[model samples]
Target: MIQKYPVGIQDFEKLRSENFLYVDKTEFIYKMADIGGYYFLSRPRRFGKSLFISTLECLFLAKKELFKGLYIEDKWNWEQSNPIIRMSFSNIGHKYLGLKDAIDKRLDEIAEEYNLSLVAPSIDQKFKELIQKLSAKRGKVVVLIDEYDKPIIDYLGENPDKAIENRDIMKVFYSILKDADPHLKLVFITGVSKFSRVSIFSDLNNLDDITIDSRFAGCCGITEEELADNFVEELKTLDKQEIKRWYNGYTWDSSTSVYNPFSLLNFFRKKTFQNYWFETGTPTFLIKLAEKTQLYDFSEVEIGANALAAYDIQKLELIPLMFQTGYLTIKSYSPMSDVYILGYPNNEVKKSYIEVLMAAYSQSDLGYGVVYVDKIRQLLEKGEIERLEGILNTIFKSLPYELWQKENEHFYHAIIHLTFSLLGVYIQSEVQTSDGRMDALIRLKDFVYCIEFKLDESAEKAIQQIKDKGYLVPFSAENKKLVAIGINFSREKKKVEEVKWEVIKA
Candidate 1:
């Protein structure tokens, strides 16, 4: 019998009581309880953080019946029950409503739940009193905060000043955890981004950030083994490799690769390959930041793991925003240099980001971009170089004037990169060759396109550079037709000016 897929079900008791399919992560949850007093985990939104927090609430409440046959049933102590002080910032409306007001209302509800008298007027003071009162009356308090950064991240784009103010308020609110350590049993915080030490967690200095810790890397996401073991019936009819290609590349460390839990569950239920998670929350602020900066290449972004965690209201680096928010993930890591190479986590993110970027930068609808990408693929497969040139020209000319007002090769490279990648074809940009680097290389089953792009120069010069630099030499071993194309973008005209090509049998 196939179990019901728990899509959008954040309540642990409800999920288990309804006989929903659950990938067993209780082993890691048990381990976390044993190891740390205060913990923080940074995962993309809807990656099972809420459900995990709910599960923690049940465990602390000693709801042992819920964990009947799970991994932690025998390992956990069922006699000990703590008063859980659950504070969720997940569904707060802080855009129009005041954030402080929201916190006060939630605190009021919590105080009433525990039947405690609140003397403090401020939100932080109320939180402190709740912990102290709960510890004195029942037992030590277990605090689980879900989406702790939502108040700040929600207003980051619309009102940055509001976001910063929220950040300061949040800092004071969380600082109580340190002072109330004597009354706290365990504290777990989950959010989308990990703000730096000096920013959000400055006062709460004892937070064990298990974001990149290998031991708990598989805590939040469904692993390959978990998927295969739990969904045996689903695998009989599905293409496993295709599923992996679409949703299984999010990694916090080099060792473990996890499937996006939200997308994977939806894929099984819908029986379709779609950008489920990306569509749910695309982060428009991030796409706009990518375009405005034009300062760096999104296709070629590399930063150390430490750099990826340094995000705050004031410092909005595109790399950290993308990396932490699930657009980009760890492609590889160099222990020697202590740097991590970040790229699109899976095909879903790659295609969705291109669609979003195209719409935002080119002022075209997503459907238009998809149709044009299909046209580009057809032209490339049939070796229709001139028609491909016309499509490129049309695409560039259609872009908004504000987009191309500044002349930056990185901007052009990013646009072209998105265009080809959206075609759902194999592509590599700025590929290194022995002599020099190739601007773009596209691969088809029967043909390969060695593309050289130049700005404010003749197409002939671009073609000469491809040959002079021996960019096509790497493809000599493949027994397919090699097509060399040189394209020039006129900075003055803000459009493609020339295209030259030659197809040679390999």
Candidate 2:
């Protein structure tokens, strides 16, 4: 039978029954058996973390029928099936009049599943009792908690101290698992972001974070190999150019590139590609993240080397934000460093972020997303550079500099690059080439534009710098015209002061 894409469908049983196209990561089940007993994996929202955990639940419950034709069918022993207990906290309350009491209510539901009650006063006691009772009832309990950090993540900055208290409560409850291990077959947990070090997940000391474990990296999301092999028919019906520009690019591992399961499946299902992930609603926490912590330099800010496993999520670090929101992905692994080089995950996540950044920079004028790209493309193909400059000027004029003032000179330039870069436009900040380095490189179709920006410096000086550096030498062999532009910024108005342009014929 033919398979269709499983766009938003994550329920394992539901997908199997409905015949939603399923990529068999079931091989991972056997792969994981050899790894640690307790594991934690963090991925962006809608990246299929829930589905992975659901598959795990099925495996432990010894659902042999489900694995009959999958990758793990021949690899597993179908003789033993353990008792399964699954809990998802993605729907936890974001706003609570009482906070602590709201957490109690949420945990209470998990308690009911085991017919366990907390005769003890605190929520932690309720959680501990629930786990202990479940462990006793079955020969071995397989506990799968999806979005384990959701309780506190929902209240992160709203009432930070309250968030801390909720974390403390979870830490206490999870700590019980160490003793419950005697009766626990396996335990798995997942979330959008990891806990902010200390006092969180304090109980699960044996928790093995496989977020960067190279062996299972392809478990949650779909790799490009899987896409090309599985979705060849679907691609034949779509606009190939539009599809690549929107859904391609997340370089997870150099050897295995991945398409966002969320966006890829949706694009085929609807025969369209819009902001499928954002449709769930922007994580307001992202806005609060920048505002609470003065992280004004996300764009052009370089993180030289880092490990996804060791990256700190505490008190707002760039790596976590980039990872949590789906900007940076695991690119390469170094067993010695135990680290991963994180970079843009896919075209959709990167492109959609401009909409978020615009709102952060200027709450007022972010209304005009540079998405008017096709319109820009239309004009460019029609040779409307003069009109293009006018429109560019108008867009800059509308920018609220005051909104980005905190970022200083760096913000000014980063925002400029970010603005154009977000529109699927190719922008290079401080690029280096054989003909000497350029402050910026803007590519539109076959044409290449070299640009230099100056503040309190003459536009002529900036223009001369471009010429002196021989920035135009490299474009000599191109079929399209090359343009060199010098931009002057006003220390006075704090916006694009003036632009000097020199267009060269091919």
Candidate 3:
């Protein structure tokens, strides 16, 4: 019998009771509970953070029957149950009611559930009162707050003032966790973004942020080992490597990578490779920010450990935002300098993200962008350089006239970069050689194209630059056919004015 995959089911009791197949993550829960403390984990949305929090709630509530054959079954002391104040900011009706009022109402519900009354008026005071009363009545209370940043993240881009207001309210609301530590057994908070400690978590100094901790990297998502172990029958019909290529590259510590559970499960259900997770929500703000910063290429983005540590709303850095929100992930790390190399996690993210960026930059619909990208891919595969150039010119021609500026050179390069990047082809932009830097290099199965882009300059000059810089030197001895192409965008025409290419011979 095939096991039922728990897709979109966040409730642990419902999942287990309904006989849903669970990738056992109880060992991580045991590790955390055995060393009980206030912990905060930041993972991308739809990566099973909510389900993990629900499992934690069940574990703390001493639901031993739910863990009959799981890892934590015999490990946990099921008799020592604690009052669980489980709150998910995503479902708290914060959009209709204000953040503070929504939280206040949730606190009231929790108090009522425990058969306790709270005279505290403020949100923080009410939180503290609930914890103290719960600890006094039952044992110590366990607090599980899921999507803790939703109240703020939802308002971001749409309303900065409201986002800031919600952040401040959360600052005061979460401040109680620190003071009420005596009454709390465990406080586990999960969110998509990690606001700087100076912002939302200023008062909660003791909270251990294990967002990038290697030990718990596999706590939330489905790891390679876990995927193999759980999806035995499911793997029989699936292309394992293709699946990995599409979904399995997200890493926190650059040591243990995991598949985006939302996408992975959806893939099994649909039996097709699609952007299941990315389609759930578009990163409109991120795309706009990338365009503002001209950050189309993410192949070799490097940042210090401090950069990924935290970022406040006032100083919204693009790289950190992309990293935290699941667009970019740690590809490599250098301990000597404590620096991280970030890139797109997988084909799903790279293709989907670039498609969105292409649509936004080109001022066209996503379908048009995708069709152009597909055409470009086909041309490259067939070595149809002339047709490829025509498509490139057409892409630029479609751009709105009003959006062009004198310094719109980067805009042209960005569109081209996003176009090639979307093809899931091996590509490098701004490639540095011994002599000079080359604008772009695309490596296909049968052809290696040395490409350079010039603005208000002759295509011959761009081609000569590639030759002078010895850009093709690296691929000189490769088995594939080599070709050099130069493209020039005219400032007056605001489109590709010249396209030149040469078939390199050894």
Candidate 4:
């Protein structure tokens, strides 16, 4: 019999009662509970953060039947149970009611659920009253807040004033936790972005931020071992490496990479490898920020440990935003300098992101961008060097006239790089040689194309530069045929002006 996979299930009790397949993350929960304290975790959206939050709620509520065979079943004391004030910000109607009013309403609802009356007038006062009352009535309370940054994040790109207003509201609201610490058993907060404590959790200084802790690095995502253990039958017919390429490689620490839980589960359910996670939400703000900064490449991005925690709404940084939001992840880390090397976590992210960038930069729809990439891939695979000029022209022609700027060359090169990079082939841009740099190099099965681009200059000169710089010298000994192509873009015409190529027989 096949197991039921929970594709979008976030309720732990419902999942367990319905007999859905669970990844058994209770061991991490056990460790966290055993060393109890206030904890904050930051993970990308759809990484199972909500489900983990729900699991914690069940554990604290002492739902022992839900944890029958799980790792924490025998370890936890079943006799002890605490009152849980679980609140998820994502569904709290913050947009319609305003942040302060919405929070106040939610607090009132929680108090009513616990059969208590909170006569406090203000939001923070009400929260403090609820905590104190709950602890006084039935021991200490376990506070679980999920998507704590949603209210602020939802308004970031649209309304800065609203975002800041929400931020201030959260600051005062969370400040209640500090004074009510004596009544709190364990406080676990989860969100996508980690605003500095001084901003949101200023008063709650004792909160332990385990966002990058190695011990809980695998807390939210599904590790390779977990995948193998949980989905043994599902892996029988699928290519493991391909699946990993599409959905794996997300890591907080340099080691212990895990698969995107949403993507992995959808892959098993649908039996198709599409952009499962990326399709759910497009990073429109991040894409615009990238375009503003001209940050098309993330291959060599590095930031210090302090930089990861340096998120500010007033002064938004692109790299850290992308890293915290899942566009870029830790590729490597230098302990000596406390710096992290960041890049696209997997093929799904890289391909989908470049497609979005291509569409945005070219002022075309996503369908056209994907079709353009397919056309380019087909032309390159057939070694039809001549036809590539027309497709390249179409790509540039799609760009609006006003979007062109003084940095025409950079714009043109960015489109070209994005085009080839989406092909999922071996491609390198601005490759350095002993003498000069090659514009682009594409390695196909039977042909290695050394490509050079020039603005206003003649294609013959562009082709000659490749030869003069000995750009093909490195690949000369390979078994494939060598081909050099020069493309010249006309700034005046705003399209590809000429294309020239020379085939050197291998």
Candidate 5:
């Protein structure tokens, strides 16, 4: 069978008609019909959210012809289709700072089709006028707004006052949702960030957020089952190891152990599994947020609800922003402490994020392609602690002063192992041992080295954790010497505070 790849394309009908690769998420359609009147999904860009929204649009518009051979092809009742009002805010703020002018232009593109002349000066007025007319004419309206937070997010940092201005304007306009609830059948909205509930849904009391709801987990990204089942043919054309390493770590509620929709398609189309999503755009907002917070070593820190909840994020909501914006995701949720473990969604995100972080700090992207094995070989063969420490120190110094937790302490200690592996160093993070997690394990050229890093803790503690936990117990008889290192970091100092190395040199 010929393989199909949908790359940089979000339109549902087009993809369906063109016979592009499609992972059937038609189940979400009926689920949507059961959920609350309005829906909100927050995921990182290029996660197939736009396409999902488009699918919703097709369903609402009763375009059943496009869903043939899909899960929901025969499940939906086409007779109940409603008129969908779709709007995208990609180029929203070019002419309007207030909702009035910005929305006016958008209304002119969509609301004009209703044969209604919207001359309202404010967004609230224009929205009210359009909804009233559209509802009165069609009897029901299905509102699907894509990238609903784009205007606010794009305006931010570039111009905060304007974002604030647009926020208030959106408040008034969207408030009509409550006022026009009876006339609206289905409302689906998507955005990059989950802003204050007070910001967008002032009156959207029925807004249902299925973002983390385990039921609708597979609504956006491709699932592992879906990828394996559907894209197995495509997989045959790519390097299996590289593909998995780059795109396959995300496990959303079990079913979503999958590839990045964007990167997956791009890989098939371009015949390479490069950093497609990361190269698509630089998350300047996230970089700025990190710098502004001086949050050194983001990877090393264990974050919680206060970190993920959009409701309490103060002054840009960096952690919460990271979760919603796609840099991190809930890996594990502990009920006892109500703690959630967040990390890169997949190998693709991990590699891309590291590249971006490296570039931000060092003004150069770490060529994380394959040299990692070589680095691991060298680091372990000669027990080159200085070489590894020196590379990290130089990169850590490249970090802007604002993001410096401590000038001498490198914030990247969290991923020193991941970094080396990313560089093809063949290292592992949090490797298991009878003593404890070896923290890191580097293997290359038949040689293995166990490594550990600690900050605000003694080298003895770092090494002892390995000893107490028996972290190095796994490689005792692997035909090679086992190396262990406990490195301490000083936040105020920003570099390696001390390095204590011990090797079971053969």
Candidate 6:
């Protein structure tokens, strides 16, 4: 029997009634409703935020018939139901019409649903009045907002001014939640980023942010166990490890990571390995932000707990935004210092991101990058030193003039880092070897290359430093061949000026 996979259908009642495959996340929903009064969750786009919100809608409405065999069926009270006020910002109207107009239109729709009229002059007042009126008759109102930051996120890159304006409108609109707290049973808001308090959540500061909260870490996305238990038939012919490598490393905390539900479902439907999650949309603004900030050290990017929670359009930080937006994820956590080390979540992201970055920064064709990666891999495997050097020179020489003019060392390092990474080889950036930290370490099946990159310095010095530092001492015993490569870039030319290499054994 072919199971119906809910690809774009977020309506929980329809999904359940139509016999679609639903990974039961109601247990978490039950715990959250029973435990909290107000909550905020941050996850990437298409990571099941909409579906989660829809589930909460059904749950709050006490639609017990839809959840007959689910985990929450026995645990929840079927007799008790609250009037649900659901709003999603994904389809909010024309940007030129402004956010206030969109809010008014949405409020009018809601008012019609309740068979009432709202005469409030502003969005905030309309929201407040609706909450009071609904809860007055229904006992208490349940509020669930999906894609709460869509209006602002959509305008972040092109119209930053509008983004800020929309944020102000949203701040005013969401502020009504706090005022209507007395009549609200549960308030749940979900978005892509945790916009800082002063910007978006100032009035709603009491809301508990369960983004990194360990208890609800598995709430939004499909967990490894959930996938195994629910989709056993889908796994019989699939490479489980490939699926894990492609979509299984999005982490909220340091543990209990989950797969992107959109990608996993598509993988089953399509029966192929591709970047389904990224293909939905890659924010050009975020990539441009990284390039503008010269954030090339993709490996050791770290953020404090406070910084990670900070998201203001006026003063946005690259590390936190990348981590929150799903381009990068929590690699590790330091309990003592309250910091998170963030990196590309999985192979799918790393590859897609590099292609995006290269295209954005260098205007290089993604297909060309893939071809160059294959050529470079073959060159390294055959120990073609001079040809490999020429390839590196060509890669740098082809960089766009605007990017070349920046002349930032970090930018150049990013180019090199991405080059080796695309080849699917073992690449350790800034590897701490026996004596000193090596710039990069690349390992293929038959060869190990110690790479040292220098600016405004001789290539000979780079190789000597690698040798002096005993960067290859740890690999001396390995039977595979070893090579030390030194690459030097000239700031004036904005390209590789010299290349030196020493093969230890073959």
Cα RMSD for candidates in order = 2.4, 3.8, 2.4, 2.6, 4.2, 2.5
The whole-model lDDT of each prediction reads 0.82, 0.66, 0.85, 0.86, 0.68, 0.82
For model 3, how does the per-residue alpha-carbon lDDT over 1-506 read when each residue is reduced to its tens digit?
A: 97788889999999998999899999988888888899999999899999899999888888889999999898888888899999999999999998889999999999999899999989999999899999999989899999998987886777878888888898988887887878989999999988655678888888899999888999988999999999999899889988998899999989998999999999998898988999999657788888778788897699999988768776678898899999999999999999999998988888888888888777788857777777877787798888866898787778777768534777777887777666653233335567765666777778888888888998898888777777887887888898889888887777788888988775
For all predicted structures, in order, the TM-scores are 0.93, 0.85, 0.93, 0.93, 0.84, 0.92
What count of clashes does model 4 give? 0
Clashes of each: 0, 3, 0, 0, 23, 0
Q: Kindly report which residue stretches of model 1 are placed more than 4 angstroms away from their true locations once superposed.
A: 92-97, 401-411, 424-436, 467-478
Candidate 3: segments with Cα more than 4 A from true spot: 405-407, 425-439, 464-479
lDDT of 4 by residue, 383-467 (tens): 8888988998887777777778655777877887787667652233335567765767777777788888888998999888888
- Considering TM-score, which of the candidate structures 1 and 6 is the better prediction for this target? 1
- Give me the overall lDDT of model 6: 0.82
Q: Candidate 2, residues 1-506: lDDT per residue as tens digits?
A: 44677777778887887777888888887777534278887777888888888888777767777766898887776787766667677655535434456557766776676566656577666656666676676567777888877777676656667677767766765766787777677788888776553356666678887765567768777776787778888767777656665665554444555667788778787776677865576666676565455453343333334423333334656566666557666556565665555555545666666667666665644436564544555555555655554555565566665554655565566555555556443332235578665666666666677777787686677888877778877778867777777777766566666767787544
For residue 400, what is the lDDT in candidate 3?
Answer: 77
As for candidate 2, its clashing pairs are 175-203, 250-345, 250-346
Report the C-alpha displacement of residue 449, candidate 5, in angstroms: 1.3
lDDT of 1 by residue, 137-246 (tens): 99888999989888878887788898889888888888778989999889999999876445777888888988889998899889999998998999999999889989
- Candidate 3 lowest-lDDT run of ten: 423-432
Overall local distance difference test of candidate 4: 0.86
lDDT of 1 at 1: 81
> For model 1, where is the 10-residue window of minimal lDDT?
424-433
* Residue 234 lDDT in candidate 5: 69
Give the lDDT ranking, best first.
4, 3, 1, 6, 5, 2
